[model samples]
Target: MLLAIDLQSETPIYTQISEAVIEGIAKGQLQKGEALPSVRTLAVDLGVNLHTVNKAYQLLKQGGYVQINRKQGVIIEPNAFPIADEAFKQRLWDRLKPAVAEGVCRGVKREEMMILLDEIYRDLNKM
Candidate 1:
């Protein structure tokens, strides 16, 4: 899995990790049944605490992205895809709300926001 971590980003590390894994799946870069790096390995590689990686992995497991086993390690679900959860929804909203508000503060009209949103949505759908 390829991830770009920004410690200074407004988003937290765990959230960024979870979102990156999910988006990798969405972008067809991460396939179902693929094995993920061990938490310890990833922590060492990323120079982060083991607990951070564990927390991220736990979030992925809770979202049904991957399954963990004592001996088998972590395996991406056979059909890891869309996950609908209130927490995920709220996280998305919290991230977007700030950007949207910034645009609004800059005098972006509602109709313009709708247009921009549609264009962005279409661009993402193309992926």
Candidate 2:
């Protein structure tokens, strides 16, 4: 999977890296057990600090999205992926609340928001 990061984005570099990897998994571009570039390699390739890539990898490992092995380096979790548990649901809801609130503030109708959401969901799945 190719990762593109915006240096100027308000989001932190590590967050962007982690999110891109997550999105790749969601899109089935990064299969289970697939190995990712080494942290140092990715950092050099992306012109970022090694710590940034390591931080992203650490987050992924903590989330059960990847495994780090001395021999294997980093790979997507081979045995299983995380299910959307209550905690995950709560996190998702928390993250989405702002966008929903923004829509509300802008007087966007429910149908309009739903339609927009549908379009984005479909677009991501199409990749």
Candidate 3:
């Protein structure tokens, strides 16, 4: 997968790496069971430290997006969609609350927000 990073961004490099992987999956650039590059190789390619790549991989694994195998390296996980468990819902709410609040504060209409969400879903589904 092709991953890019913005060194000047406030977000951490590892977070950016993990988000790129997630976007790849959403865009169908990555498929289930697809093998990812070794952490060291990815770090070298991205001109970052090994630990940064490793941390990104670990986050992906924790989020159920990838799996790490001692002999096989890393691969995308099957059925990696987010579950609707309470914990997942809570976390989703926690993450969205700020953005939604900001939208409200900006006087964004419900229809506009819904349209934006639909556009994003359509974009992802186009993969």
Candidate 4:
């Protein structure tokens, strides 16, 4: 997977790594059952710490986006994708509310935000 990390950004490196993998999956660049680089390998490739990559992988595993195996290493979830349950919905809301609030505070209109969201959704789904 290709992860674009901005070291200077305020966002944490591990968060950026996990987000990139999630985006890759959404964009169909990473497929189900596909193996990801090992923690050490990815750390070397990205010139980040091994712990950073491992933290990202752990987050993905917790989110049900990937699975780690001793023999197989790390691979995309091979079975069903995670269902959008109530817990997920609440989590989504919690994560998005702050961003939406920031946009609102910046005087971004509802329509404008919707348009931007639609564009991003379409772009991610374009395979």
- The best candidate in terms of TM-score: 4
lDDT by residue for model 4 (44-74), tens: 9999999999999999999999999999999
Model 3 CA deviation exceeding 4 Å by range: 79-82
Task: Write the number of the candidate with greater lDDT, choosing between 2 and 3.
Answer: 2
Q: Please list all clashing residue pairs in model 3, or write none if there are none.
A: none
Per-residue lDDT of candidate 3, residues 60-124 (tens digit):
99999998999989999965566779998899799888988999999999899899889988888
Steric clash pairs (candidate 1): none
List ranges where model 1 is wrong by over 4 Å.
Answer: 80-95, 115-127
Worst 10 residues of 4 by lDDT: 1-10
| TM, every model | 0.75, 0.93, 0.89, 0.97
CA RMSD per model (angstroms): 2.9, 1.4, 1.7, 0.7
lDDT of 1 by residue, 1-127 (tens): 6788888988878888888887776666777888889998988877888888899999999878989887889888887455667887998899799989999899999999999988866654555
Model 2, 1-127: lDDT tens per residue?
Answer: 5899999999999999999998898778998999999999999999999999999999999999999999999999999988999999999999999999999999999999999999878866865
Where model 2 places Cα greater than 4 Å from the true spot, the runs are none
**Candidate 4 at residue 33, lDDT?**
99
Top of the candidates by lDDT: 4
Clashes of each: 0, 0, 0, 0
Residue 125, candidate 4: how far off, in angstroms?
Answer: 1.0
Of candidates 4 and 3, the better by TM-score: 4
Span of ten consecutive residues with least summed lDDT in model 1: 118-127
Locate the minimum summed-lDDT window of 10 residues in model 2. 118-127
lDDT values of the candidates? 0.83, 0.94, 0.91, 0.96
